[model samples]
Target: MKTFKSILAAILIVGTAGFLMSCESELESKGTASIGVTDAAVDAENISGVYLKVNEVQATAQGKTKTVVAFDSPKTFNVMDYQSGATYDLGEGQIDAGSYSELRFILDEGSYVKFKDGTTADLDVPSGTTSGYKVKGDYEINSDSRTNLVVDIDLRKAFVKTGSGEYKLRSTARIVNKDRSAVINGTVSGNTADKVVVYAYEKGTYKESETAEPADGESRFENSINSAVVANGQFTMAYMEEGEYDLIAVAYDENPEEDTYAFRSASEVDMMVAGSLLSVLKVEANANINVLINLDF
Candidate 1:
């Protein structure tokens, strides 16, 4: 009886194991059938921070050229997945130069792009191009989801201005050469009065001679050229007649003959009665004004 019972028990165990295996297989097959693949579409609603380009540029009030990038701040961009027709909102993201970022779309199975609202109408993903995704729309508020995704964006550009305005020509001169190494400074008068008298020429002639003296007590020259002399060694001639004038400084050293030397600047400025402005032209704010001087030099 024991031997028969053992063999019967082994057979029953085998049969039960086989039945469980078949039931598991059937359950898996039913599950697969229940999960039927279906085609669906998604909705694209809110979008923001769309980047656009500008063509023309303008200068600032300060005469500076400026360039700028356009973008929306505190806005949310909506990302739509094309597959399963499901749409989700992707929060605001940075849009870098030379490239763009957008939501990925899903189509049949792993296929995507067709579902994206921005995808080309014909829904063709071009070769060599990442995908054919277009910016659909932009919005400030989220009406449907009630969930607000804020988008913050920054834009930047580089621009350069060519020239700068001319500054008032308030220059000073001092004797630094040998002999008359003394400092010669002087004050400018008239429209050039911006410069204050600092020093006079050490020892130099007006042009060629050691001292600029009146031709005679009778005053031969009708108009006396206006000149400024500083205590140190610098002097300036204003309202000078349009003519070639040489500048020289006189020095009183132990030896009187070679004590004085003539000096000139590396460059010379010629004044034309017609071309030169009688008065300084001042540019203030946005308007230009002509300034005249009446004080004696």
Candidate 2:
């Protein structure tokens, strides 16, 4: 009886050791994914900052979700500060080496927007804490290598004011492999409008309805792949995937009293003599393309 009990104990100890070894091996097989966030220019007047508190970032691979970045405490970021090709690193974590189909950002409360006049209003994120915001794309993580990713949040289309005189987040964001994306930089001259915004759409994706006034709680150019506000006669749309895109320049009337930029009209491009030969601009990975848009105001 004593000999049998001793053998049973030894077997239990061996089994436990093997289980721990398996877990360690699984952890060692993971790769590191470094994530960051960026934003395009917001198309509103007197807006000083857009703040967001991120609790964590998760990735889904083969229908299994795992955290790739977890903060000790919720990290608050002024997303507006990372515009025009700038990014804010959200830190890194280990993820299983595989192809992820989607990435989500879990946010916390206390997100708000500050205006230039020392006033702030709560920016509500619907289902931000529960469902989170998702960015769908194909991302590959190799074992023992670090992959860099940047989440581009186009604030122009994302920030909307509700009927109750409140603001809410209806964001459109995309995750791109930092090393595999490109940037579009250009100058907009000969403009007489109060403001100029450049919108980039996938080839042949722009529609006349996009220029129409959006319904309540919506904004124009909602379907643009990305957008940039002309600043000091220059504009930049970064982290764009390699493909052909159509550029649309639009004019706006800035009303500082109401803190709004009302849509005016879509500007005509100077087709004959501009930086880009064609309206359809071709962008390549890891390259910068300059497109000049001389608006016929």
Candidate 3:
């Protein structure tokens, strides 16, 4: 349980020889630390708002975890509104100058998601409402530098809907070093179909893989980045880490009777970024997107 100052003093004493050097370069000194949240572009077109009530924010270093900011009570954010670089500031505080290995957030009840059909349901965060959701990352906080972190709650992989209509929240948060992130913006056209979804999967992903859910404590990492839903034919992929990616847009049939879900995908598009440029791409859907599903029956 070393204070930020003591940790910095130790690093200075060692002249930041090894890991400390990398961390020091990546972290800030005498700067403020803030936590924000963003969405990973879900195809939940009917889901308008996914509000989460966060109770406490904590950071850990040197084997000791401390609450950086505890809500006087609790606060909620409609996660859907945070997309493509958009974020809801959880809060800010003086970050300790140490090698932080993890970050956690305690959530409370009163979390729910609303739908476009005027229906709303509770978002069940199994054990998360009281237990908290945590993820790992390296953070070095110096005295005068700003350290900002954003959490990517992959709504596509995190929010699961069961046959019995149970809404579950899986622990699938991706922490990002905000200063080193990029954004992707795009648009969809020739899509007259309802419930058209656009996703940014890692290149070489199988289209059917979208149905696979992550294990309780696993990352669904194989090209599973979801895309922000299109608004007025425009879409955005925010807070992306540097890498190559493939984009796919699908329009699904909502018929409940069929066990198999039928959908159409747009022609694949490729994306890549090495630095901080907000990349953009255009994806065209299959020409028959306007076809009626019931017509087949």
Backbone collision count in every prediction? 26, 0, 14
Name the candidate that leads on lDDT.
Answer: 2
* Global Cα RMSD, each model: 34.2, 4.6, 10.5
lDDT, each prediction: 0.22, 0.84, 0.65
Highest TM-score: which candidate? 2
The candidate with the higher TM-score, 1 or 3, is 3
Deviation of model 2 at 65, angstroms? 1.7
TM-score of each: 0.13, 0.85, 0.67
Shift in Å, residue 233, candidate 3: 3.9
* Worst 10-residue lDDT window, candidate 3: 288-297
Q: lDDT tens string, model 2, 1-297? A: 999999999999999999999999888788999998889868767789989999999999888889988887999989899988999989999989988988888899888999889899998887788767777788899888899999888787888877898888785677899998999888887888888888888988888788887888888887788888888898989999999888888888878788778888984353322334686787889988777777876
Q: 1 or 2, which is superior by TM-score?
A: 2
